[model samples]
Target: MTSSAENSGQPVFTIIVLGASGDLAKKKTFPALFGLFLHGHISPKTRIIGYARTKMDRPDFLKRISQHIKNTTAPKVKTMLDQFLDQSTYVSGAYDQDSGFLALEQEIQRVEREAKIYDRLFYMALPPSVFIPVANGLKRNCYTTKGINRLIVEKPFGMDLESSRTLSKALGALYREDEIYRIDHYLGKEMVKNIMILRFSNQIFGSCWNKDHISNVQITFREKIGTEGRGGYFDEFGIMRDVMQNHLLQILTLIGMEAPRSSNAEDIRDAKVNVLRAIPEVIESEVLLGQYGKSEDGTMPSYLDDDTVPKGSKTATFAAAAFHINNPRWEGVPFVLKCGKALDQQKVEIRIQFKDMGNAIFHKDVAARNELVIRVQPQEAVYLKMTQKLPGLGMDTVMSELDLSYASRFTNLTVPDAYENLILDAIVGEQSNFVRTDELDEAWRIFTPVLHKIDRGLVPVEIYPYGSRGPKHLPEFVTRFGFERHAQNYSWPETSQTSVAQAVAALSADSKL
Candidate 1:
C-alpha cells in the first residue's frame, strides 16, 4: 500500500465526485465511499466534495446520496454515515465551463486551508459526452499542484477502435497515464481477483493450465432483466460493447495470461497485454448475435416494445463469440465469451473444462471430465467438479464437486463491493486492478471489426425470447468451440450432508446395508 504521506507528502486527502447528482453517483460512487469510511480506510483529515450542474442544497444532496446505502438498525453505522456525510459537501458546477471549475477550485482551496487537505482524487460519473470538456475543465482550473491529482474515469471509453484511441489521446494529453485510473469494476471483483492466486499459488492448477490439459474455457455473464425503459442507452452499445469487449475480455486475459515476474502493477498489466495481443480480431463467422423479443407468456414486452428504443432497432441484447490466442501455451484452446440481458438467470462465471481421461480405468460414460468453475457473482465461489467411486458394492462412479462457496465458508466476512475495492486502489496508487492505455488499445482492437459489422447491419441478429437462455443456436455455438456439456446429471449439494455423504446414505438405504 502506498501511504499518502510517504508518496505525496500530503497530510490530508480530498475526493471530488463529478456529476454528483447523477444515478451513478447516488447508487455506486457514494455507497462505495461510505463503505471505505465505515471500514476506517478513510482518514480523519480526508474531505469529500460533490460537483454537478444541478443546483441543490447540501442537505438534499446528502439525502439523495445516502438513500441507496445499505440500511442498518445499528446506531454505530448511522453515526459513521453521519460523519462521512458531514465531511462531504456539494458544489454545483457546469461540466464544460471554466467558471464552474474555477469556483470548484476556490472551494477546494478553502477546504484545504481549513483542513490542510492536499491530495485530490476526482471521480467522473458523468456521461462520455462531457468527459473531454470536464477533463479539460479540471486540468485548467481545478488541478492541484501541491499534491497528488488522480482521476478515475468510467467506461464505454468510446464506440470503437478509432474513437477509443481519440478519447485516450485526449485524456493522455491532460493527465499522465500514471495519474489516471481507467475503472473497470469487473477487475476488482472478488473471484476475478482470485484468478491469479488460484492459478499461480496452487501447483495443481498451474501445471494443467495450458492447451495440453485444458480443453476449453467459458466466461459468461447473464442479466435476468431487460432494458426496462433504458433502451436508448442500451441500443447504442449493445451487448458486445457493453459487456464482452470490456468486462468479459478482462476476465479472459486474467485466465490466459502468463505469470508475471512480480506482483508489480506494470508487470501484471504487461502480462495481460501480451495475452490480448495474441488474440486475433473476432471474425464474423465465429460470432452469434441475438436480440430479445417478448417472453413466452404475453406478460412481458420485447426490446422493440420499449418506448425509448428506436423502431426496428437491430441492436443485439445477447452475444456469444469464440476467441483463440495464437501463443504456445494457449494455442488452439478456445476461449468462449457469452453475455446477455433478459436471460433466464443472472450469473457471471468462468468455467475451465479439462481434457477427458481417454481409455482410462473408468469408462468415459461413467466418469465425467474435470472442470474448474469460478463463480464471480450472486454467490462467489471456486469449485472443481471431479469424479469419484460410488460408496457401494457396485463398481460405479459419481460426479461431485470440491467446493469453496464464499457465503457458506466465510460467514463473518463481507466482501467489499467492486467500486469500493477500486476506489481504495486509486487512493493508494495501485494500478494493477485498473486498465492501462495499451491494454485498452488492444482490447478495442480485438472487437472493433465485429462491432463495426454489427453497427452497419452487416451481421444478422437472431431473435430470442426475453426470458430464454439466449439464441436457440447457443448450444451449437459453444460446442463448435470445443466446449463439452456433461452427460451425467449433477448438482452441487446444498444440503446438510456433503455430496459423498449423501450418496453413501442413498446407497445404504437402497441396499439395506
Candidate 2:
C-alpha cells in the first residue's frame, strides 16, 4: 500500500496517458482528467502528458482532445480549460522502441525538476498486445524513484483464465500489486459506489441479505446497439470476456460478499475476492451463449454480416451464466449474469428477488413478489417494489416502490462520470473499487471452463435478432436457475419525466405573468 505521506496532503503529480490517440483515451481518459481539473480535484502544479504513436503538433493534439471536453460555454470552465490545456503536452512514441520511452522519461524529468515532490501516474489506454512492451519501456526508461508511482490498467485483461494469469504474472514481475490499479469502470458508478453504504449502513437490508430472504440474484448488462463497424475488435473478446467476466462479475461479488473488516482498500477487496472464490465453476448446462442476427425488418445487419468479422464465426455476442456459491450466505442462491450486444434496451442493473408469498390475504390476486433493484445506468436509481394497499379501496393490493432516483431526487448535484470517479480514486491510491490480482484470478477460474468449451466448439452459440431481447431461451434459462417471473406486470414510476413537465409548466406560468 502507498503510505499517506506518499499519496496524501494535496496531491501534486504528472499524468502520462499512453495510447493517447486511441478511442478509450479520447472518449474517457482525457474527459475524466478535465473533469478533475474543472472541479479543483488536483493541484495547480499537476501536469498531463499525452503519449501515442501518431505524431501531431500541440494544436492538433489539443483539437483532438477538445471533442471530448465539455462545459466550455461557461466562462469559468473556459478559463479552467485554458489553464488545464496549458499544462498539457504531447509526444509521439512507438510502444516497443526505447527512443520514444527515453523521450518520455525526459519529459517526466522536466516536470519533476520544477516541483519539490516527484509523483507520477501512467495510464495504459492501449490494447493487451502492447501492455507488456509498454510496461517494460515505462519501467526501464521512465520509472520515478523519488515518490509514488501508480499504473492504471484497462480491460479486457486477457482472453481467458490461462492467458489472464500469464498476463498478471508478467505484469506482476514489473509492478507491485499495490502499485497497479486494474480498473473496472463499473465499480466507480454512482449506484455501485453506494452499494456498500446501502448494505452495511442499513439494517433493513444488511440483516436480510442472504439465501434465507433472497430467492435469486440477476446481474444483467444489455446494449441496444450492435458492434457498428467495430466487429473486428469485438470478435477478439466477445461479450463474455468483454463485459460478463470483469464488469458483471465485479457487481456480483459486491452483492454476495460479506461485510468488509474495515474501510481500508485491501479489506474491501479481500471480501470481494472471498465471494468470487466461493463460487463453483459455471456448468455447461447452466450456460447460454447467443449471437445477434439481422433485425426483423431487415434494417440492421447481423454480427456475421460485418466484413471484419469472419464468415460463419461462432463467437458469442451474448452470454448467460448461472453461478452457485458454496458459502453459507449464498449457498442456495443462484447468481445469474447475462450480457449482450443489440438487445431490447441498454441497461445494467442488479435485481434481488425475495421469496414469494404463500397464500396471503387475497389468494386470487396474490401480491407481487418483492424485488430490490439497483439500476446502474440511463438513470441511476435504487428501488424496492413491494405490495401495498390501494388507496380508498377495500383490501386491494398493488405494487409500489420506495425509490431513490438520482435524476429527480438529486436535482442539484450531478453524478460524476464513472471514469472521473475512478481516475480520482487511482490518483488518491484507493483500491477498494478497483480489481485486485487475486480477485481477477478467482473470476477467471470460475469462467475458464465454460469459455474453453465454447472456444473448442463443444458448445454452440444460440441466435437472437438484432434490436430484440436476448435469446428466446432466456426465460427458460432464468427459470431453470430459479428466477421467478411475476404474474403481475409492474413498472417503476417515471419521476424524471414528471420533473421535466413540472419545470416546463412553471416556466410557462412565469412567461404568462
In order, the Cα lDDT scores of the candidates are: 0.91, 0.88
Q: List the candidate 1 regions with Cα displacement exceeding 4 Å.
A: 1-4, 7-11, 494-513
Error of 2 at 426 (Å): 1.2
TM-score, each model?
Answer: 0.95, 0.95
Off by over 4 Å in 2: 1-8, 115-117, 497-513
* Superposed Cα deviation of residue 177, candidate 2 (Å): 1.3
lDDT of 2 by residue, 67-90 (tens): 888878899999998988888889
Query: What is the overall TM-score of model 2 with all chains considered together?
Result: 0.95
Candidate 1: clashing pairs of residues: none
lDDT of 2 at 72: 89
What lDDT does model 2 reach?
A: 0.88
Residue 424 CA error for candidate 1 (Å)? 0.2
Superposition-based RMSD of candidate 2 using all C-alpha atoms, in angstroms:
2.6
Superposed by TM-score, candidate 1 places the C-alpha of residue 411 at a distance from the truth, in angstroms, of: 1.1
